[model samples]
Each structure stands twice: as C-alpha cells, then as structure tokens.
Target chain A: MKIELDNLTVSYQRHPAVHHVSGRFMAGEATAIFGPNGAGKSTLLKTIMGLCAPDSGRVRLEGVERQAIAYLPQQSEIDRSLPVAVLDLVSTGCWQRSSWFRRVDRAGMDAAWQALETVGLADFAHRPVSALSVGQFQRVLFARILTQNAQLILLDEPFNAVDARTTEDLLELVPRWRSEGRTVIAVLHNEEHVKQYFPQTLLLAREVIAWGNSAEVLTDDNLHRAVDTAAHWLERAPVCHVDGSAA
Target chain B: MTLALYDLVVSPFVEFGFMRRALIACLALALSSGPIGLFLVMRRMSLMGDAMSHAVLPGAAAGFMVAGLSLPAMSLGGFVAGVTVAVLAGLATRFTSLKEDASFAAFYLLSLSMGVLMVSRSGNNVDLMHLLFGSVLAVDDAALMLVAGVCSVTLVTLALIYRPLLLESLDPVFLRSVGSRGGLWHTVFLLLVVLNLVAGFQALGTLMAVGLMMLPAITARLWAANVGAMLAVACGVAFASGAGGLLLSYHLELPSGPSIILLAGLVYLVSLVVAPVGGALPRYIRARHRQL
Candidate 1:
C-alpha cells in the first residue's frame, strides 16, 4: 500500500509535535524514520496509524482498511507483569477474525503457532512472555505483527535495548517481508544502524531535515548538524553517529 | 462442634432471603470482575476503573432523587454517568496525547468533586457517606436483581470482547494491525466497567466497589501462574471475602458492605505478604532458606 502524508500536522494542544510535513512511503520498501530525541519521529508514525489524527492535514493510507495497519511500539510500552504465554500473545493477532469470547479455533491456533515459528520462538510457545529477554520479547511482539499479516508495518524503536545478534535477527525479517511486498517503516535512534539496514530514510529534528537513501541524506553536514553543539536543550554534544561506538 | 462448618455456612442462606440474594449477587460480581480486573491491572489502568466508579456518583444521586432510592433508576443514572466519563476520558486522552492516567485523574477528581458539591446542596449529607462506603446489608431483592442483570450483561460483553481487550492491553499495536481500532476497544471496555460499577455500587458502594475490583485480582496475581488461574483465584478470594465478612458482621452486628470491603483489602494485604511464590513472604522464605 502507498501512504502519502499530505502536509500532515499533529500537535499536543497548541504545540505541534509533527509540523506540516509531507512524505511518501512506497509499497514493498523499507523506510526509516530517524531523528534526535525530541524530533517527532514516533509522532509521525502514530499519526499515520490513526492513533493520533492530524490537526490540519491528511494522512492518506491509499490501500488498506484504517485498522489493517500493523504497528510494533517501543518494547518499553509493554507491561512486564502480564501473565500471557508467547503462544497466547501471538493468538491475539486472530482477534478481529474471531468472535469476542470464542475460543481460539484450530485455524487460529495454527496461525499463532506459525507466527511463533517465524519469530523462532515456536519451541518456547508455552513459556510466559514475561520471562523473555529483551530481544526475545521484541521478537514475540514481532510475532504478533506477523500474525496480523498487515500490508504496512509501523515499528517505533523496535531495536531499543536489543543486543547486536538479536538486532540482526530482527532486521533479517525486513528483507523477507520486502520479498512478500510489504512496507516496513521503523523509528531508529542510532543513525549508523539506520544506514546499515534501511534502504530509504527520513531525518528529522522536529521537522524533515532530509529524506532519501541513507548514504545520501547521512552526509557530514546532516551528521554534524545532528550533533551540532549549539545552544541546546538535550544531552551534551550529540555524539558522532558515524560509528556504533560514538553513536 | 456438633454442626459442621458447611451447616453453619448454610444457616444464612436458609435463614434470610436478603443474605442469600446478597451472596449470590456478590459472587456474580466477583466472577464478572475477575478477568476484567486482571486486564486492567496488566494495562496499568486500575486507576481508570477507580475513576469510572467514582464518576457514577452524579447519575446515582440524580436517580435516587427521582426514584426515591430505587435500584433501576439509580443504576440507569449511574450507567449513563459512568459510560459518559469513560467515553469522554478516552477521547480526551487519545486526542491530546495527554497521558491516559492524567485524563482519568482529571475526570474522576472532577466528577467526585461535582458529586460531593451536588450532594451537599441537596441536604443529603448523611446519605452521601453510604454512596461512598455502600450498605451491603441494604442490598434487598431489587438491588440483587440489578446486580444479576448487570453481571450477566457485563460478563457476556467482556467474554465476547475478551480477545481484543486482552490483545490491546498486552499489545495494542498488534491489535491495531489485526483490524482493531484502539479507541473502539477502549470505549467498549470502559463501558463494561461503567455497567459493572453501576450494578455493583448498590451493594459494594462506589469507594469500595473499585477497591474490591482491584484487590482480589491483584491478590490473585501474587498467587496464580497464568491468566486462567489468576481469574479463578480472584473470584475465589472475592467470594471468600464476601462470605467471611457477612458471617463476621452478622456475629458482630456491624456493617456488611464495609466489612466485606475491608476483608477484601485484608485478603489483598495477606496475598501481598504471603503468596507461596509471587509474594513478599515467598521471597523472604527463599532468602532465609539460602542463609540457613
């Protein structure tokens, strides 16, 4: 599905979190929404998912039901005390297809199992998700997304707190999804990580700084500006995002 | 000693019609709230339940004013108020990205204050306490009927939407992808909560109502290993609190509703301290065992 944000604007009361930004996310591609801490990256994706409606503009999700969008929020948003097993979590994907109180049918169960397998957690189906490592939990969430079989995937900081090996494991799912002609958009904090994985990127500092291929938009000017030691409000001198160590 | 505990328990059921009705309705409310409470706690929306409970005050007061303290009128009024707050709160939070808790806190406090102000103006000061604390002993046939009706409807609604509610609570993003609108599910669950409190407040009272809703479920979390078991334990504990509180209050000539709520709180405290694995006592035991 093609998503075009025609001068999208969303705000918290009067303060605009996402300004009049326009962009296009083509189908069958990976797009990274990258930015500094308060750059409205997540806000843009949230507006796209209809979680937050635009204040002054429109988000045209050209070819899907408003609810057909799949999103994986930051892992921190999940409740740690939840008692659901990995299998049970995956079964939530079949919810729209089933009646409210009905039991998971054979097909639904199969779908849950299939999702778990894709996330490589089929063997741990019965394990409580609360028992998972950070990476494992993220995958379990991805399993939820996969089971949704959504046309567009909106991921907000999926790689946060995940180790390198797990990051690779998760990133590998993108290409496979791309092969199936699905759209994947991720919010990345690490600039180098975005260059390493995503083919297309949108850079933001509460506005669209640059948008294009990672190598092209990730020039030293943009990189330096991202780290510009101007009279600023955040952590001291944003680190050189050229390498993982400084990033 | 001559009479078994079973016979003793049956004495109330056989002796008093009102007690039997209260017991039955209490049990039903307990069952209805267990699963919903679990999800609320998981979503960190327990306070939302509390807010919804308190939000019913104005509607209840209006109903009682019109119908002379009757069941249907009060519940209908409270249901309207409750659903309104739920819907309004949902809209306020999502539209503004103001934290859900912040919105809930705002609505509940405002409604609570509004309720109190109105009650004061109407010269119903003494009766207002009962609104806050409840009068379980006063739950007669009519109130019991209301409770039963509410329980059936709320439980059925909850069971039907169980999958989406649980999914959203645990993983809202995933629910959205599977054709679930976050606002829609939120509004539905909030409505169920409104109905539960409306039906239950006559017996449990608003203050005690949300407390009872949260206490048993939270206690159960410290005992049960999974969602199914948590619900089972929550209902069991709620029933135990009702039965024990009733027996103790009858023996002591105290208020049944407050006694039951206090007992629920006691159960929560005990579970917090003593569940075998998940509670503080269990952790202490393991530490002691290691030291020994």
Candidate 2:
C-alpha cells in the first residue's frame, strides 16, 4: 500500500517537535528513516501511525488491497521485566485486526504460532519474553508483526543495538518483506544499512532534510547535518518515554 | 417463619432486616470492586481512587447542607463533586506539566481540608459522622438500585473494552500502533474508575470507599495471573470479605462500611505475605528455594 504524510507537523505544548514534514512511502518499498540522537524521526513515525496527531498534516494509506496495518513498536516500548509469555505477547497484535470486546479466537492463536515460527521463535513460543535474549525479544516482536499479516509495517529502530547475527537476520527479513509485496519503514541510527538494504530513505532532523534513494539521502554532509543540527537533542520528547528509559 | 432451623446462617441474610441490608450492600461492593480494583492496580491508579474518594467529602457535606438529610439529593451533589475532582486532576496532569501523582496529591489535600471545613461549618456532628463512617443498614431501596445500575454500566463498559484496555496497560505504545488511541482509552478508563468509586461511596463512606476498592483487587493480583483470572478472584475475595464483614458487623451491631473495609484490608494483609505469586514473603521464599 502507498501511504502519504502531507504537511505533517507534530508539536508538544506549543513546541514543534516535527515541523512541517511531507513525504510519501509507496508499496513494496523498504523505507528507512534515519537521523542522530534527537532528530524527530520517531515523532514523525508516531504522527503518521496516528499515535500522536500532527499539528497540520494528513496521513493516508492507499493503493493497498489489504486493509490491515501491522505496527511493531520499538523494543523500549515494552517492559523487559514483565513476565508475559511469548505467545501471549504476539497475540496482542491481533488487538487491531480482530473485532473489539471479542476474545482472541483459534485463528488468532494459529496466526501467533505461525508468526513465532516465522521469527525462529517456535521453541520460545511458550517461554516468557523476559527469559529471552535481546535478539530473541526482537524476534518475538517480529513474530507479533507477523501475526497481524499487515501489508504495511512500521518499525521504530528495529536494530538499535544488537550483535551482527541478529542484525543480519533482521536485514535479511526486510527484502523478504518487499518480495512479498509488504511495505516496511524502520527508524534507525545506522546509515550504511540504508545503502546496503533499503531502496528509499527519508532523512530527517526536525524536518525532511533529504528524501530519495538511500545512496543520495545517506550522503556524509546530509548525515552530519541531520545528526548535529536537528537530531542532537530532539528525539526524547518525554511524552514518548514509556518508563523513563528513553536513552 | 421458623427462625430456629435457619438461625445459624439465616440471621445474616434473613433474621434481622438490617443485617440483610448490610449483607446485600456488601455483595454489591464486592462485585463492583473486583474488576474496578484489578484495573486500578494494573493502571497504577490506586491512589487516584483514594484522592477522589476523599475529595467527595466536602461535596457530600455541601449536599447535606442543601438537602437536609435527603439521601438522593446529597448523593447527586457528592457524585458531581467527585467527578469534578477527577476531571480537574486529569487536567492538572495534562496541562500543568505536573506529574499525575503529584497533581492528585495536591488536589486531594486541598479537597480534604475544604471538606473538613464545610462539615464543621454547615453540618452537625451526626450528619458528618454518618457521612464519614457510613451506615449501610440505612441504605434504602433507591440506593441499592443506583449501585446495581452503576455496576451494570461499568461491567458492560469494561467487557466491551477489555482487550484494548489490557493491551494498553501492558504496552500502550504497541496498542497505539495499528490505530489504537491510547490516550483516549486512558481517559475513558479513568472515567470508569471515577464513576465506580463515586457509586460505591454511599455504602463505603468517602473515607473508606477507596480502601474497599483497592484492597481486594490488590489481594487478587497476588493470587493469580492474567486479567480475567485476576478479576474473578478479586471479585470472589471482595464479596467474601464484604459479606463476612457485614454479617460480623450485623451480628455485633457496628458500622457496616468500616467493617467491610477492614475485612478487605485483612485480606490484603494476608495476601501481602502469603499470596501465591507476588506476595513479598512467599516470593522471597520461592526465590530462595529456586537458589537451593
């Protein structure tokens, strides 16, 4: 599906976190949003996903036959200490797809199992996520995404800090998603990965500083500017921190 | 009616009319409090319930001043006042950039002092005492109906939004993705809490209403895993505590509300050390055992 975020501006308490940003992410494209520490990449994604409202922008998902969207929030969004089992964690993804008030059905459980299998978490399906390694948790999150069967996927910093193996596993999954006609958007600090994997990029530092092919947006000059000027101090909106572990 | 054959268990529900009334009130409090309390603990709004319950005292006194011992009229005034405090507290949290508990504390203390002043100025000792300790035996049919109606609305609303609410409580940002309005749900959940606390205030007294809501739910959390099981266990314990306390109070002829609250508190105290999972001592023991 093609999604458009036109003139999107997200502000908090009169301070503009995301100032007048516009962009379009087409279907079957793996889009990467990158900036330094504080650039409003996460804020922009939040606005687009309808988590936070943009002061003046419209976000629409079009050109997709499927009506479903799967959202995989950053790892920081979940409490690591929570004793929830992996299967139950994935089952929550069905919250959006299933009807309200009704309990998760057999099909939902089946989907969760399938997603866990896809994420190589078939064995950890019954284990508590707290027991899993960091990479395991990320895969668990991916399993949640798989459960939704969403044509459009928005992931916030999927590869924030991980060993090479986990990164490679996730990097390999992106093209597979694109091959399957699924759209993926990930916010990241890693710039080289953009050229290596994703085809499109929306580089931001409080605004869309550059947008186009990965090679063009990941230019060293644009990269430094995005990090030093806009991103150096903006990502921690305080409102977005679930448990004060924003760093 | 042969009173002797039923005398052992019948007195609580049948022998003395006042006892029957207290027992029934306890039943309502128990059921209403279970699901309500579970969410409160899960959402970290236990203290908010306390703040709101205390905030209504001044309003309760105001109601008494206006209506002169009229139950419905006073309850309406109290309910309005409680809802106002909850909303204002929410606004203070959202607008002033103050933390939620801090704002709740400020509002509660202010309301508490004001309530005490109003009671002293406008109400006599007996009215203030009744409002504080509550006399559930004196609860009329109208009050019973009101509690029942509020319970039905709350239960139905809770049922309708259970999954989204659970999802948000567990991981709100995740809920927000794929089109969940976590903020909106937060407001709605808080609203439900206010309504339930206010409804139970008549039987529980403004002072003890929060205690009644929190203790059983907290205790239940110690006993089980999963939202559904926690809710059921909480309700069971809440009803038992309320009913047992009611029967005890009636047999002994004391204030029913305080009795029920004390009973709920008693359950909490037991759960605090011995509950299956989260209880402090039991958890420590389990950890030590695992180490061994």
In terms of TM-score, the best-performing candidate is 2
Candidate 2's error at A183, in angstroms?
Answer: 1.6
Candidate 2 stretches with Cα past 4 Å from truth are A4-23, A53-61, A64-68, A79-85, A126-134, A161-163, A207-209, A219-222, A225-228, A231-247, B1-12, B251-254, B287-292
What DockQ results for candidate 1?
0.45
lDDT of 2 by residue, B1-292 (tens): 4766466557557656766666676677777777888887877777777887887777777888888877777677777777777778778988887998998888878888888898899868887888887777777778788777777887888888877776777787776565567777777777777667666777777777777788888888788865677888888888888777776676687677888888888888888898886888876774434542
Taken over the whole model, the C-alpha lDDT of each candidate is: 0.78, 0.76
lDDT (tens digit, per residue) of candidate 2 on A1-247: 5688777667776567776677788678899988776677788777666768776656776764322666666655676544467899899878755755777888999999988887788988777676898888888888888888778888888876677888887788889899998899888767678878899998888777888899878888887777676734544545432221121
- Clashes by residue pair, model 1: A100-B160, A101-B160
TM-score: model 2 vs. ground truth: 0.85
* Alpha-carbon TM-score of each model against the true structure: 0.82, 0.85
Q: Report the Cα lDDT for residue B260, model 1.
A: 85
CAPRI-style grade of the A/B interface in model 1: acceptable
- The reply for model 1, stretches above 4 Å from the true place, is A5-26, A32-40, A55-59, A64-66, A74-76, A99-108, A189-197, A201-247, B2-7, B84-98, B106-110, B113-134, B177-179, B287-292
Chain B TM-score, model 1, reads 0.93
